[model samples]
Target chain A: MAGGQERILRRRIKSVQATRKITKAMELIAASQIARSQARIAANRPYREGMQRIIREAASADPAAARKMLATPEKVDVAIVLVIVGDRGLSGPYNSSALRAGDRLVHMLQHQGTRVRLFTVGKKAPAFFRFRGLDVEQSFTGFADRPTFADARAVAAALAAPFVAGEVQQVLLVSTRFVSAGSQVVESEQLLPLVMPNDMEVAAPTGLKGYTEFEPEVEQLLTELAPRALESEIFSALLEGAASFHTSQQRAMAAATDNADELGQTLSRIMNRARQDSITTEIMEIVGGAEALRSGK
Target chain B: MASLRVEIVTPESALWTGDATGLMARSSEGQFTILPQHTATVGDVVPGVVRVATSSGEVAFCVHGGYFQVGPGEEPGVTRATVLAGIAERVGDIDVARASRAKETLEAQLASPGDLDDLSRAQLTGALARAELRLRAAQH
Candidate 1:
């Protein structure tokens, strides 16, 4: 029986080692992706900041016109919630945290008596929402790991059409924001009405107030800039989400690998003790048999 | 002496950034050029060639629809001009073969115009326009 126990322990240790190999490999891959995604975020910084600056300039030039497009609507009959998450699982709470935030946002909106249209950006979102009796209008998949500007454009188009057509008055986004390598926070914010820069974190210094000149005038420029600004915002959000996903995945896989190592060590120690016990039993049986033979002789 | 700093940036990356004598691009209003000491101007850049004249030579970029901002730079008398494009590339970097092939394919798709949805059709037209711009920019 002890020998059998030893064999079982050996098999389990082998399995743990195999799983550790997989986790270690995954950790390395995710680590590599973290750097690349971070670089992409850096590359996109200028464009995003420039777009924001231009918006700020236009918004400052004509506050009334800006209010028409940027102000929150008083009566919201319908709203769209866009949730971004990872395509794959096993990335710790990266996917679940965002999904839960989105779920809560949808519930809160429903409590206000507003009709909710749900749109998701990952393969894992639809099932989670549908199981809760929520209807998912559209789900974009297959590009969560590495998103392109085109992907962001597609998402922006989908979200903007209803807003432009007056079918939806508000657009809300729920996703993870990558603040740094060690910090990522799940945040929910408004996508439509363009969230004026003054309300944003890095409010422009408001230099040269009305001195900036607009070619076709500020009103028309802001109108044309709205959708482009939306695209830029979505693109940056997607980039941050990707970086967070990779970082979260790398940390999770590293933890899993450590757990496997601990499990393997514990299992092997038990197996060693079990083998020693089985050897002791065999030795005692031999001595007992020899003593009985000697007495019989 | 006054100086100009030009930056051509896209969502993916900054295509070009350097000191230049002049920046030339067409806005919806008309053809315009930004030189040192230019006034603060914000405008949309139509999809076409954007030229930057440096002291050594001139460089061209094939910019699909985007926006531009001309304002004062960090140091006094240094004008900063920033061009933000959703998609753009250096004219010299444009692939002629690929652009022509894409143009041909898009034209064929448009000619047939099967049950393509409104969104896809619009996207196709946009792509065609970019391809044509790239080809036209590369020609010169």
Candidate 2:
């Protein structure tokens, strides 16, 4: 190998060491954030489930009154899509997957002649869409990693505005859904006018006879409950996105740390071999010279 | 002949869960009460205080908005209501400065001329309103 090759190897080793230090620090930081994100997820679960159940029950109670809000999409003209992603990326495909999914959806909608008005959450969405020449109607970043309910409400409001103004026919939410520590899937959900969850889940696993009467009529209840339902769903989605973001970062950092370690080991091995070769050459020369001197004497 | 089981769950945590003698909640129609063996009723919970009487004592919680379901059957009294944002405890537990900070941010947003959109401003107002109520309740 050229002498410069050893110098380059030394430089690479140093670089890897620095990268390892950074990755190790990031890994620890993300690992700590995971617990908080998990806790936030856990804390919000009861509310979302309860909201879902209430919406289901309320819809079942008055199917006629709920018809306007709980609509099955027949045609789409203008769709407002909300994409939830992280502001910063080092998290492997966490940002890319969401960005790609959103792009695909936008393209699909445009192909169908549907006007796509996009509202992006997280820092990455704006840049991603801009790169592809897609216009983002609104973008909110810095809240994906540690989102609060207020953030969700802000997003929900933005989605609902176009629907309320008749500018958009349907509202869709694009987000990463966290299934488990090791599994997360990006999905696009309808987020406007508050559609009812499936009947199968709402019928209360225990089918005991039940009758619930409302005093002010079902429409009024729907009016109040529908908005809250949307808020809950959005909050839950944010929580999932946050959990997924942290998990992805932790995993990516760990892989980086491992690669740095492997590279470090390889460099050390090569250095050791080089040192051995030089020592052997020196010993051989010494022996040859000693033999020559002995013979000459 | 039986007691009512009441549950008030907030998004952050299950705020209140236990058996109750009677309780009155501000419903969409009006104020409604639930006692032992009350009629089965489900209605929208408005933004107000819910007073629940239990063995410990009568306690009240400020609920943003939600829905409740009460049974008509003789299955004792089962009433479950869940609110996404409610104060189970009082402002007593919250730090004065922190609560004021939340209030200040909300008030400032409300006063700002369209810095935030209408919906976010509304949410901020609502949160601040709730925080203010908590502070008031704590003083008493």
Off by over 4 Å in 1: A200-205
lDDT of 2 at A26: 98
Q: Could you give candidate 1's per-residue lDDT for residues A1-297 as a string of tens digits? A: 887899899999999999999999999999999999999999999999899888887877778898888999999999999999999998999999999999999999999999999999988899999998999999999899999999999999999999999999999999999999999999999999899756632443454533888898899999899999999999999999999999999999999999999999999999999999999999999999999999999
Scored against the true structure, residue B99 in model 2 reaches a CA lDDT of 69
Candidate 2, residues B1-140, lDDT tens digits: the string is 47677777766667767788888787767888888677656676776677788888887776656677665333534444333453345333546677678888878778878768765666677788777866665555
- The residue-level lDDT of candidate 2 at A205 comes to 41
Error of 1 at A247 (Å): 0.6
- Candidate 1, residue B87: how far the Cα is off, in Å: 0.4
Candidate 2's residue-wise lDDT over A1-297, tens digit each? 435556777788899899999999999999999999989898887778777766666677777777777775678898988889998889999999998999999999999999999889998889889999999989998888898877777777777666777788888888999999999999998887576566534464432256656666777777767777887888888999999999999999999999999999999788667767767877899999999999999
Error of 2 at B73 (Å): 11
Task: Give the DockQ of candidate 1.
Answer: 0.84
* Top-DockQ structure, candidate number: 1
Alpha-carbon interface RMSD for all candidates, in angstroms? 1.0, 2.3
What is the CAPRI rating of model 1's predicted complex? high
lDDT string for model 1 (B17-135, tens) is 99999999999999999999999999999999999999999999999989999988889889999999999999999999999999999999999949999878998999999999999
Instruction: Give each model's whole-structure lDDT.
Output: 0.93, 0.78
